[model samples]
Target: MKVKSFKYLLTSISVLILVYHLINMFIFWPEIPERIAIHFTKGEPDNWGLKYFLLVIPLIGLFLWWLIGLLTKHPEKLNYINLTEKNREKQYTMAKEIMILMQNLLFIISIFANESLLRYAAGMENGVFIFLSLFLLAVILISLFFNLIWAATLKE
Candidate 1:
């Protein structure tokens, strides 16, 4: 897909995720526990906070989308890991792809966390917790691995 289309897809998905959280927060506010799990350690919920703290997920997602848009709008502002006169264009393309992928991944992780916390608050089983955690780690690791390899292949 074209970069512009991919950017739009990311933005669209982010907005949809935010809307889902907001709607669910409002509809289920009364059902959520007084204190909800806000942090986890070793795959277990640890830190706790008021249920309303769930808003942080959508807020952070919004911030990530904005940051991604800013970066995509001005790729020149980003630092390159292997920038060179001959490889600059290819390197910048890779950087932009990384930014886009990161933006999407971060938003997805935030959404998963929000859903997991909401489930816990409602006294429901945390079914997605492990999957979400693993997915987030995998995306970051794979993105880094591929991007670095791609950068290495660029003409110097």
Candidate 2:
């Protein structure tokens, strides 16, 4: 996908997730406890806060969406592997792909985090954090593999 399209898609997804979260929060407002689990470590809640603090995920998502959109527009400003006149185009494409994937990953992670917070607030297990971590690891590995391929191709 084009960088602009990819950025817009990521932004749209983030906004949709935020809307879903807000609606879910309102739906479950009555059941939300006075104190909610806001932070976790080793799969255990370690910090507490007002239930309204649950909005933090969407807020972070919005900030990240904006940042990604801006960065994607200027891939030349990003650090690139094998950046040379001959490979600049290829490098920029690679960077755009990487940024797009990262943006999508961020959106996914935010959604999972928001859901985890809600589940924890409702006294349910927040096992998805581990799952999300694994997904992130996979994304990083895949990104590295693609970077290697692009770098090797650039040398040709």
Candidate 3:
């Protein structure tokens, strides 16, 4: 696939994962909704702190994408986005990798955290967990290849 199309697909996948995570937080992690209300003095570890941190990965990935669009304008059929510098490409690629890694971690967690997601659908027993884990694992594997590809392509 072309770089642009691949990036679009990745963006879509990342967004979906992020949304799923957010919804999971609401459904399973009671600590999530009580975040701001949670008192540090209560001595409770931040509720679902890792999930919150995981959520930041995709947000940062989006920010990097938006930055690349704003800074570089090289696509032949460029829309409102632009990416003129090589560093921007590298940065975006790095952010994408980080996002994928974060997602894979969350996917694994969801498999075990039944309250976060119903693993069993139709009595299949956490079918979504099984499927999502596989999907996220595939994404992570592909991302490793892309990481090498981007590194090679961006070489001066």
Off by over 4 Å in 3: 1-89, 104-124
Which tens-of-lDDT digit does each residue in 41-142 have in candidate 2? 876779989887777777787678668867877898887666789878878887777777777677667767877788778766767664874687588678
Clashes of 2: 0
Best by TM-score: 1
Cα RMSDs, all models: 2.3, 2.7, 10.2
Model 3: per-residue Cα lDDT over 1-156, one tens digit each: 344565566557656766775576455544333233211233333433333443444455456555545433342332212344655654555654444354434434343333222212112244455465667667667876776566556533
Candidate 3 or 2, higher lDDT: 2
Off by over 4 Å in 2: 1-15, 125-130
| Number of the predicted model whose lDDT against the real structure is largest | 1
Return whichever of 1 and 3 wins on lDDT. Answer: 1
Show the colliding residue pairs in model 1: none
Model 1 lDDT, residue 122, Cα: 82
Model 3, C-alpha of 5: deviation from truth (Å): 16
Lowest summed lDDT across 10 adjacent residues in model 2 is found at: 124-133
TM-score of model 3 vs. true structure: 0.33
lDDT of candidate 3 at residue 64, scale 0 to 100? 58
